[model samples]
Target: MGIPVDVISLYRKACEHDTALSGYYNRNVRVESDDGPVMVRVPSAGAETMDLAIWPEAALLDAIGPHVPSAPRLMHANIDPPFQIQEFVEGALLDDAHPAGAALPDAVLDDIAAFFSQLLAVPVGELPAAPSDWPKDGDTASFAELLLRLVRSIRDRGDQSTARLYRDLGVPEDPCGLLARRVTGLSTRPFRLLHADIHRKNVILGADRTVFLDWELALCGDPVYDLADHLHKMSYLPAEDERITAAWAQVAPPECRAGWEEDLRFYRAYERMKSAVVDTVRWARLIALAAEPQERRAYAVELADKLDAARPCWIPASDTVLTPDDIERAVDRWSATGGTG
Candidate 1:
């Protein structure tokens, strides 16, 4: 592990990066110059998404900085032991309890809709086909397998919360034989670049408007996956209105928020199920690595509470409408898993 970085050090690093400050997600001192204020957020690294560019943030800054509109300017970067310093992103994180998903006034929902619509309008294929360390098989079956492994990892560590959620949500035990063949065969097309994890937390509020953060999980494929991600990370309140939601209703030749309502439904179920499974693993890791035993205990308690809250409804259920294949997969997973991913 590297030396612990704090607020002061982050301030210096911000100046070094030639920005007002670095935003949250900086482990080694995140700060910048406001033209000099620094924003720093420190979170644990997940080994699973290591290649997602969790460490050595420079590589990510380099890859995505130019691609996204309204993103923080990347003045400088380096990738020694995995550290990243970027211009601080301004804005408040939308509250999970806030019903407005994107945290905007009702009047602003149309603008928000236009924002995402315009975002989708940002042409793809123009950028070079950048190399990525994306999984060998980026299919649903492979993804299910990854989730199952994560479940097993936590289970082995004596944290069955993750496995239990998978079980309750009807996730299969493992993506072996039949399940693999079936899910893989379902989709007949290719994939595209999707910001896999774009929750309210990953979004930053700006004077101009909302902007995204945490692009490491960015991958090429499935516009539905991106839409599903929104549902998965839905905050308690929505910053959306009819117009904003309706903005996604269009069916263009190259639909940005691609897929029919049914496709969106399928992807939502898939992504939400995966989120529950992963949250458990993440909780387990957080607890296991906590320096203080009391902290670990409290975290476990929080995990249990969260699971209980999900008993009647998982986060995405209200927003998720289902179709046949989605139902079939659910039933199939429930039958096989016996209560674990």
Candidate 2:
């Protein structure tokens, strides 16, 4: 189907009015379409760091929408400028209402579990084309190795200027080596579609339905990793965390949930280790580009928090943990040395 002319028109108008929201990967604008309000999303092209996508998100959404009702309905998509128009979910973000470390309502928990069950049930052939090197279903070890390779690629391409700053912040010389060694012993499990990135911001709580957004980070892998990723990002209360884990296990296929109690720790550690690498590079860029004192300090504080969050996964712990004040001082010293590349 051709991209709707009217939607394109609306998108242009939205852009002109400066209503576009610049997120990490896309610039989104809300516009009214004939069917109802829709969101127009244009890719940020080169501005993403954690995107470990093997398939185009639009194709993934189209293939899974029938099975996963929580996924947003694709209204129209264009490749020339790389934008997609999806049904704009009306309501609030799950984060806005619940926030991190808060307990979720029972209904919301059920909704999350249902989303996972439905997505995992989709046959592999039904989804979009994956990379030729993509791990075969049930190859948990290969999948883990693939993640390591992809993250290593990101690190290699990262700015060399940030290397010194990362060291100063206690980031290990090589963060993923331990994970690579550990994944060798991963037990085999049936693989299926994993949302891969499902934090509160990606969820919309509407009047009638909950919608999951942003499939750019989706991957085919052990379903247990998805649960681990969710737990790490949401920071749900300990009680709620246990409840959600139980709920997920109840609905998940037994084959998919096998050895989850033990495997979950490995995946969680991988997530933390991945964060340390990604956050360091991102923080360097943000710190270097920051224009105002307040903005620079805010980014420094965020860097501190992210580093602290990933501290447990650091293979060899740094000399000392970094506080916000420590980070700010490091940033200043690093900047003075012309380390901002």
Candidate 3:
């Protein structure tokens, strides 16, 4: 869709007010509108340079708004030069009160489970259509294969420098192939909406309600995969993890929870392996974008840390891990190559 003049004016007003809020993929700006305060969310630089999303978030919200009222209300959206104006949510972040690794309060846990149940309750027929290549519901094997294919796509489309950096870090060229073999025997479950990236920052704790943010990463897939993703990213304490798992199972239907316990590890592994690939490319880009020596080094260090965290998932025992010096050299080499990150 073409850009609206009013939208441009709102963006200009945000810039003039210097009200841009920090985010990874978008610059969220707080601006005044006739309706009151609203947030204008515009994509960050090069957001479409990679084909990473399975569905457009605005469309998803438009379809599922009535089903999941806890999500922010989407006021307007545009595809080309993409931007979304949403109701300005007011609340403390879930992380602010219950930091990573900390067990959430009981009330908060129940609230989160309620959110998941409601989200998963959305009728498949009512949601945005999945990608043409997406697997049919309950096809766990095909779902796993599709994820591997996405990682392969990222590797193929990414710069050779990023590929070389992975090799230097001892990440196997075909870890996805290995991962495919290991993730077998997963039980099929009815497909439903999954808020795949539901970590601390994505949740807001309001006075009377808990609001989930960033529907951009939502997918239709195994319900267990959603739980596994949440567990892996949230890093809750072991006891708390068990409680949360039980809570999820209690609320989710039997079809959705079937064989979840056995399959959780495989899904977690997938999350880690994919993170290793995605973070490498992103951190390399950040390093390239850094104008100062220290900033570049900082991003390089973060890249190294991300790889190290995922080492068990993507690196082979036969291969040696990349050292800090190795990471620094790789970053420097990639930066010298001068391609737009």
lDDT of 1 by residue, 231-341 (tens): 556532433523344555652225343334555655545444444445554554565556786786676665554444333223222333333334334433433444232
- Candidate 3, residues 1-341, lDDT tens digits: the string is 56778877777676566557656677788888877888888877866433246788899989999999889999888766578888888788888888986768988888878988897789999999998988898998788777788787776665687677667666678767657776568888889998888889888898878999888888898888889889877888888788888888888988888888888888888787777777776777777788898987787777777777667765354445566668767767766776346
Model 2 misses residue 223 by how many Å? 0.6
CA lDDT of every candidate? 0.46, 0.80, 0.79
TM-scores of the models, in the given order? 0.58, 0.91, 0.86
Better of 2 and 3 by lDDT: 2
**TM-score of model number 3:** 0.86
Q: Where does candidate 3 have its weakest 10-residue lDDT segment?
A: 44-53
Score residue 154 of candidate 3 by CA lDDT.
Answer: 72
Residue 94 error, candidate 1, Å: 2.3
Name model 1 segments beyond 4 Å from true.
1-35, 38-67, 96-104, 107-115, 118-172, 175-190, 236-245, 251-259, 283-341
**Residue 15 in candidate 1 has what lDDT?**
42
Off by over 4 Å in 2: 1-3, 284-302, 337-341
Error of 3 at 306 (Å): 3.3
